[model samples]
Target: TGKAYELDFNQIALDPVTGEEQGRRMWGEVSLSRENLMPFLYKLHYSMHIPEGFGIELGILLFGIVAIVWTLDCFIALWLSFPAWRGWRKSFAFRWKQGGYKLNFDLHRSGGVWIWGLLLILAVTSVSMNLNVQVTRPLVELFSPLTPSPFASRTPVSLDEQKFPGISRDEAVSLAAAEATRLGLEKPAGGVFYSPEFDVYGVGFYTAENDHGDGGLGNPWLYLDGQNGALAGTQIPGTGSAGDIFMQAQFPLHSGRILGMPGRILVSLLGLAVAMLSLTGIVIWAKKRRSRVLSDQRRRHAEPEMQAVS
Candidate 1:
């Protein structure tokens, strides 16, 4: 249903030997465009892809910078919109008798105050997700040892160098379940992927930490030997460092998966609020520009009359 997948070259391909672009087998179909819509929004919303050819990383970098700037502006807007002690209550409520301009201004100002925290969270999480390696990851890792160093010796066995035939898929999964149980994980489920380059089985599992929804976040993972089903190493979410926890929480917080249905509704409302604020801002700007032009015209007409009187 909600799974996002790419073409499985190993299964269905035009030229398996050459590995050229080919058709794919659709494993399942959704009732709507849910599968395609998410990726399209993700790519466009975060500036991950424009023309869809090249420079995706560069596009993300540029958008990451813009997000940072926008977040800063949001902070400034929050500071500026803060109501004084005398007007604090008034700031929370809109006055209908104050006319259109005041209504628009109050709605714009108060609605912002209402959603600033959500906006800030969205902005921070967006930056972290987009600039993971450069900014967020490093900042997170500064306090935690979740991510392994690049120079660390994995010494993983390659799939081709197997001494004996590899274990069956079911056996590998059994080992993962056993490992999960040994670690006291609740409701553990795992899957293994055969990586040719490393010659290892990458097994990832969901645990209690991921009890909320799909468990994409806060999942423990490990590498297993494809041949003998030996447990190479494991990363447990329960004992993960602060950085690991923060990074894991990012997706859930961004997508409102942590809070479930109500959380999703709130996020959707926040999007509408942002759009409303943007439109009101444009209207305000246009009205100000019109007023300025009319004032200038009046001043020019009065200037000649003043000159004649002088």
Candidate 2:
């Protein structure tokens, strides 16, 4: 057993570093926000069932969901964050003057540290224009002069107000295309979708392009002129704007897919970790509750017999 090539049970290490670590691959290098760190990762957190580019309304909903998860994660995070919490009997809200300081502060700090990793992922990823890159890397190569986004401003078109019948869908689309070309946007990737509520046939365009012309590799937005085909102005998806490119990428980064498959996998893994930590914390709490109940019952049952001296 001295140094033979044959297998030796006690000679090996339990946890081995992966090939990635050997390659010196770091999340920070590709991340736009390399200042933070997260030890967890998950898949669904990187890719979800949600439709793409739904907008801020959906964003708020997502926020609510993650917040709830974070609160639950606190128990797990707190456990990992503060080993001393095991002995903490005070309120999670500590107050020095009232002698409640120890309890609250312990819970607060521990809970914060537990979710801090997740928070870093969320915060850093939300600002990237496209989630196609890592937080440490720019999603797309930045232009030196930083050309104005083609879809930045809308070209106005005069339309028939009372259905004057002068303008047709063809004219509207052609005008949109022309204006798009003029402003240097990729050919219109979207067509028209009429909304009854608005009474206007809006011209739409998806932003997906490999040539890297106007927007990034996402879907097209819209331009709503009148049925008379008068251009009100250029519009973007989810309230379209040249500024939207940067904004949309942020959500993906927060979810962790901005870098590619690896990033998505990492985010998904983190989600799983958060889920596991929550479940474990709940079980631990339940076990403690059961133990307390048994102890209370045993003590109460033995109480009356101990009154001998009195």
The candidate that wins on lDDT is: 1
RMSD of 2: 19.5
Model 1 spans > 4 angstroms off: 1-35, 51-56, 83-85, 96-99, 142-146, 149-175, 190-201, 206-218, 223-238, 300-310
Candidate 2 regions exceeding 4 Å error are 1-80, 83-115, 119-173, 187-192, 199-220, 226-247, 254-257
In order, what lDDT does every prediction score?
A: 0.69, 0.47
lDDT of 2 by residue, 1-310 (tens): 3332432221122334553322222331223332212311221233332343743334434544555465455456546554565655432333445534343444345444555666555644432322222222332334222223322333423232223334566776777776667656665555555443344555665443321222233334445445556555553433434344455455555545455556667777766765654565566577679999999999987787666545
TM-score for model 1? 0.70
What's the CA error at residue 146 for candidate 2, in Å?
A: 21
What value does the lDDT take at residue 89 in candidate 1? Answer: 69
State TM-scores per candidate.
0.70, 0.42
**Global Cα lDDT for candidate 1:** 0.69
